[model samples]
Target: MSATQSYAHSRQQKLVVGFSQTPAPTTGLTRQEIRDLSLKGVKTRAASTAGSGRLHGKVAIITGAGPELAIGTGAARLFAREGAKHIYLLDYNPAPLSRLAEALREKYPNTKASPNPMRHSRSTVDQDGVLDLAVSALVDQAIQEEGHLDVFFANAGIIQRPPKRVGGGGDEIAEELRATGRNMGGIEDTEFMEVLRVNTLRWVEAGSNISYAFKSPIHARPWRAETLGIFGLSVFLGIKYASAAMAKTTSNKTKSVPGGSIILTASVAGLKANAGPIPYSASKAAVISLAQTTAYELAGSNIRVNAICPGLIETDMTRGAFEMARMAGKEGRMGVLNPLLRQGLGVEVAQMALFLASDDSSYVNGQALPVDGGLTASMPYIRPKL
Candidate 1:
């Protein structure tokens, strides 16, 4: 057996595998930064995330597609743009889900709709058989109308707290840990368990080879990669167990939809941290890296996979920043703190998400693409004399 050399120093080792280019791109800088001094003052849109129409006319099920678009809705809309006829939009919060569904209904009148059986009424992770039963129900619903589940957006996740400030000065260590506990473990046991159920475990159980999960940070600093493993290894292991269970399922309904795909949602915190809890940053970093490992392990079944690393898009997770900055104008804060000097809209990240979910990204596997408007790439001067 050939010994595998450590990738500790190679540029390739630092890169997320299967992306068109290594390390993806930061927020403001294009994949190619020509650095035109004359054009520095002008704004230029990068090539469309909707490149080449990958998800056209395919069916997709997007979980937690709340109006606020915590993660998956952006991609769902892009899926519609990609020609998806049936969109199964699901979410726990009825108000936003209904509103977003209404918007989508207006956008894609021709597309069939079955709004996820109304959560918790046999649709929530809280219900014991709900996850498995709902999985079959949703897939069956699609198969019944659309013939088969063509594209699956396993983007169901929750980041519950209203949002809190983290990463204070040297005097704030204790407060940071306290804040992290809330992020790591919810105030209510049921809520916390529910977080793990939806945010971490369900995609594995649902035959979704890919998933995206994120949360509000309790700290604003990066953690050693191992810390993330401790938090998320259970979910990765859960995926293993879930895959085994699916192998033994009495039915193999999804046998015709080609193969499985998973895109675990992570954040800039994972790779680069501006300010947040250690657990949140560490776990997110783990989410992305573990996805790399999982991509390697689960490759036998034609299951392509990847990750979506988003920065301060409008969501419950980053409300605190909004509170600190104030107004829609505060999108600048997302960029201000970030090297990119601009925050990203949910739709921006969503498009990239749809690509990974659809066959358009067939060659793309096990990568982490950042949608933070260049947040991670820019670092602030700390030492005053570096």
Candidate 2:
């Protein structure tokens, strides 16, 4: 069978194993016929179905790239599966980062995955150092490849720890403590400042990455698991303005404004209080606030800004800690917020992220959404007696 016929029969759902269709004459086909054929699920012989090319003409970037970099790995794969022309997987560390890019190449095929230019990488916890560099690098990548930046998924942060108690409004205190001069220079300052630097600032700069993408895939477990992505998760930052700006930037899809989207990953712990470090909670809360505010501010930019608040997402950062907690018999505590009564899946969250990144959400914006399933709002279905 010819490639065109093979793809067509499959696209028409006529065959389960193949999908190739003949192009109805290049310039002679009627618009309605083209639409009908497409609706009927016809594909040109040269179509890539795995990625489906949702991001076919767009660009994107993911940062921090710790083992959780797998989240980006999965998203890159999905973006390719959806047909993103240029999916940039960036990180500071080379080994794991390179591995992530290579792994993506294996799964996605033909997508360019590489270490982001050092000039744009925020290597240290202090984000301001490479803020402009990182932002410009992403912008440059998009312009050089597609002549425009479409979406920015700013997903990276630092200074994470076990949940802390909200004694006398601890989240407020954490935010207050983080605001101290310690961020740049504080006497006997704690790590909150550094956490503030990475989570908040880096997340903000990523919004500025302006490559293209969103929050759903990053926060949902089902999406993450199926797609092997974690794009759907809460971002770490306390600034609502950044998110709002992002929303505005991407939403202004006018003839003059460039089109794009922004997805901020926040934690569910922000929606609820926890007993760990105050800054972590506050940091997440800031991320949530940014999602809401960014949606409002950037609505005019044709840029959609949204926040994804996650709960107990087990990444390398938290896996060991959770396991340690498990070894110490903190199962009850660890399992407190999961709606299905289990740890959430990163890939599931990544799927929500992919939705936010694609054209599917062209009309959605300025929202602080949650993918915690019923967990964020669900009361414990089963009260376990210890």
Candidate 3:
């Protein structure tokens, strides 16, 4: 057998042995112990496929990869480890963007990493145009440097805690009120609009720009849309533009596989009420709907669209929430509502994205897969006397 085949065989053997020795945790273990085992499973899988090259020779663009532990950065890191040829990292902050780019380069010397600092503000048409222009420039740079773009991860967004005028004051006040288990009032119109603009409108604009680039005449081959995963609450617009973009086909008579995938980062809030703020929950609900509707619409075109609803994940955006819970001596209660009984990490979400991005999910599409430890399996409430 060839070297590549032999190596793959060895890796398969190792995985089989690993699974045999570490069978799925049973109910005999404590919930915490089970959660730890679940996390260990993820780590083992990652290590086993450390150099598997799932994305070999593919070029990708990942936005909102600012925080080191955020989902976007996590996806970017995993993409590189999986053998993406080149990656263009975009973020509003230069520091984190540079830091992530540096780390990727250090670890994956064969992969090219470029960092771009682009802000997403939609107060004015001019500002919106700026975002469009920035996205266009980044896509252009990727094409110029790498010759083609395979994956576009539109994962940048902002989560607004209701403004003080709405009910709670600042973030601290909001967290304090939430800790006391009091629901805040609706957010002010201005605050709500701002949040919608940044979280929704901006993503639509960026996704369109990237899609346009993919259909541009400069690219010679039929663009393969691996995964267009978006992060944040703006699942509606994110899925809309991304699916539309992926569905666009080249005019050339010759046909290729014509495969594409759109993965939206939805939240458990979208699946049920009482999981998040009013506006946030509403937006996520729209996202889930978009994923289903778009998947149906694009099925004929060989493009698959899906949404991933995550439960309590510990990331930069949720740092405050996690901190508050820990300070209240309820740290272990973070994801107690979920069957897993523990919070998830960003990489866990990345693993799901990778699956949706790869050919393994070619037959799977148009579904809102939940990676929330079975949080959405049933209506969340106290079990009454049986």
Best by lDDT: 3
Tens digits of lDDT, candidate 3, 1-386: 55665665564444333332343456455555566677778767765666678888766666677586698888888888988887766666767777777788898988877554333311001112115455556655554454444566656655664434444455674554553343445456555555555555432324433432323222223322232433222333334334444434345422234545666777788788787766566667766776787677555766677777878788888887788777887666667666566788888988888787766787987787888877787554432344
Window of ten residues with lowest summed lDDT in model 2: 121-130
Give stretches of model 2 more than 4 Å off.
1-50, 66-70, 116-130, 159-189, 202-257, 325-336, 379-386
TM-score of each: 0.60, 0.60, 0.71
Deviation of model 1 at 379, angstroms: 5.4
Q: Which stretches of candidate 1 lie over 4 Å from their true place?
A: 1-53, 116-137, 143-147, 160-198, 201-257, 273-275, 327-331, 378-386
Write candidate 2's Cα lDDT for 1-386 as tens digits.
55665554444332112112323346565433443453234223213344566777566655444354245444555666766666655445566666666666687666666553544432111122125454544545555444555555666655443324536655543443343313224322346644554566432323322333333222112322223211222242212212322322232342235557777666775677542345666767777776777566454556677767666555655555565566776543443333233444565566777899888988777666666645656432222355
Which one wins on TM-score? 3
- Tens-place lDDT per residue, model 1, 123-187, is 22211222545554555555555554545555554443323455445324344335544544445
Which stretches in model 3 have alpha-carbon errors above 4 Å? 1-29, 36-49, 117-130, 161-184, 202-257, 297-299, 382-386
Pairs clashing in candidate 3? Answer: none
The CA lDDT at 19 in model 3 is: 32
Residue 155, model 2: lDDT of 65
